[model samples]
Each structure stands twice: as C-alpha cells, then as structure tokens.
Target: MDYMTLKEASEKWGISSRQVNYYCVEGRIPGAVKIAGVWLIPKDAEKPIDGRRKNIL
Candidate 1:
C-alpha cells in the first residue's frame, strides 16, 4: 500500500498541512494512521466527495 506524509498529502490535495491535521483530528479522512509521531495518509484513501464543497476559504 502506498502512503504519503502529511506534507505530501496536503500538496496533492491542494490543502495545508494544518488542514490535513484538522481532517485527521475530525476523522473525516479515513485510512490515516499515525506512524511514529507523524500522520501518514494512505494513497487509496477516499477523495473529497465534491470539489464544490470545502471548508477552506
């Protein structure tokens, strides 16, 4: 399984690392596991449902 760090996931998702952290905290994004002290995002994790709805902005 491919995994991405918080930074990589953030950049790929067009969001901030802080926002990814928040999503992790809120349990929005599944397949996010904490390895060591950092959050690793699974490459196969579900994408955002729609492009129109976003908490950002």
Candidate 2:
C-alpha cells in the first residue's frame, strides 16, 4: 500500500495540515499510522466525512 505524508494528504484533500492531523488523531482516517512521530496516511484512503451538524427545517 502506498503511503503519503500529512502534508501530501492535506494538499491532495484540499484541507489544512492541522485538520488532517486532527482527523488522524481522532481515528477518522482508517489505515493511518504514526511512526517516528510522523503520520503516514494511505494514498488511497478516502477523505473522511465532515462531522458538522446541519439544521433542516
């Protein structure tokens, strides 16, 4: 499996690196592993769904 750094994932996902780190820490991204204090995310891993709540009338 191909793995990418947090920065790469962030850029590919069009999100902030900090947000990617948060998602990894929160277990939102499957197959994401931290090694030697660095995050390795699978290149094929889909971006996690947003958790924001929406108001529907």
Candidate 3:
C-alpha cells in the first residue's frame, strides 16, 4: 500500500495542507493512518467533499 504525506495529498487534491489535516483529524478520509505524529494518506484515496461548501446542483 503506497502512502503519501499530507503535503502531497494537499497538492494532488488542490486544497490547503491544513484542510487535508483537518479531514484526517475528523476521520473523513478513509485508509488514513497516523505514524510518528505524521498523517499518511493513501495515494489512491479519493478527496473528501467539503461539507462546509454548499453543493448547488
């Protein structure tokens, strides 16, 4: 299982690094694990939708 750091995930997801951390902290991101105080997100993990933003369809 290939894992990426928060910084890499943030860049790939086109969101702020802090936001990625927030998702990890909230358990919104699946397959996310914390090791040595560092969050390692799966490279293939889908980006979580922002609940704070309204989805106008």
Candidate 4:
C-alpha cells in the first residue's frame, strides 16, 4: 500500500504540519500509522470527517 508522510500529506491538504499533527493526536483523521517515530497516511484512505475520498484544503 502506498502511504504519504506527514509532510507530504500536509502539503497535499494545504494545511500546516502542526495542524496535521493535531488531527492525528485528536484522532480526527483515519488510516494514520506511526512507524519509527514518523506518521504515515495511506494514500487511498478516506478523509476522516465526511467519508470523502478527497482531502479538504
């Protein structure tokens, strides 16, 4: 499965890295995996809130 790093996901979503981290901490985004002290977001995972396939900017 393809995954995007926190930086990559933040860039794609037009959000700051801090905001992404907050979401991860709050469990607002799904399919986030933490490995080796890094967060990975699945490329095909749906956006947490609305079950949408696309990320909100």
Q: Whose lDDT is greatest here? A: 3
TM-score for each candidate, following the candidate numbering: 0.74, 0.88, 0.94, 0.71
What does each candidate score in C-alpha RMSD?
A: 4.3, 2.0, 0.8, 5.7
RMSD of 1: 4.3
Clash numbers, per candidate: 0, 0, 0, 0
Model 2 C-alpha RMSD to native = 2.0
Best by TM-score: 3
Superposition TM-score, candidate 1 onto the true structure? 0.74
lDDT of 2 by residue, 1-57 (tens): 999999999999999999999999999999999999999999999998768856569
Tens digits of per-residue lDDT for model 3 on 23-49? Answer: 999999999999999999999999998
Model 3 spans with C-alpha error above 4 angstroms: none
- Residue 44 lDDT (model 1): 77
Residue pairs in steric clash, candidate 3?
Answer: none
Structure candidate 1, residue pairs in collision = none
Q: Which ten residues in a row have the lowest lDDT in candidate 4?
A: 45-54
* Candidate 3 global CA lDDT score: 0.97
In TM-score terms, candidate 2 sits at 0.88
lDDT of each: 0.80, 0.94, 0.97, 0.76
The sequence of per-residue lDDT tens digits that candidate 1 reaches over residues 1-57 is 789888998888887889888787777888888878899889877655544577786
